[model samples]
Target: MPIEVKNELGKIQVMNEVIATLAGSAALECYGLVGMASRNQFKDGIAELLGRENLRRGVEVRHEKDRTEIDLYIIVSYGTKISVVAQNVQAKVKYVMNEVIGLQVNTVNIFVQGVRVA
Candidate 1:
């Protein structure tokens, strides 16, 4: 379901996929992030890095009542502090969603799927 925003003009709707893509792009701009990881679990499932075109596949967006929650599946660079990377991703996503997109994001959940050496 698309999120509807009410303003003086009328109603504006934003799709969840669009929000996910924006979040993924914002997360990619953060340091120590290698790339996004696919959220699906296949046979012999490993965290496979998703291509730029599949940004929405790596992110899951949930809207409950008036709160929006974003879940990001990511791969971080090896030797980087995992906690710091996660925090940065959280902050960046929140900033882009709330400030840039004018969307109210309640939570950003980061799941480090893997660590890439390069």
Candidate 2:
């Protein structure tokens, strides 16, 4: 009897994990960032238990050959200016993604998903 190994194929490299992680971390680092929470926390927790690599549900990475796009959906702390927070997030995320990941980001889209009370 002989043991044989099969090679896997057709893996679509949609986005770079490092860049995605950096993006998520950067977004969270912004001032007045409450946290990344799912609309349904229970479902999100289950997804994590199932070994989903991208734990931050509201963040997304759209990859291209030469550039990457970032989308961040966030909940701001109550009484914080949404505009200021969003601007900070955009600047920080863009800077980190470009300097650290060495990838050109076409855009950083910030979506104000919700506001959390203190």
TM-score list, all predictions: 0.94, 0.68
User: Compared with the true structure, what per-residue lDDT tens digits does model 1 show for residues 1-118?
Assistant: 9988777888989999999999999999999999999998533666888999999999999999999999999999999999999999999999998876788899999999888899
Residue lDDT tens for model 2, 45-104: 331111134445667777555556778777788899999999999999999866764456
The TM-score, computed over Cα atoms with residue i paired to residue i, of candidate 1 is: 0.94
lDDT of each: 0.92, 0.66
List, in order, the clash count of every candidate structure: 0, 0
Error of 2 at 25 (Å): 0.6
On lDDT, the candidate that comes out on top is 1
Candidate 2, TM-score vs. the true structure? 0.68
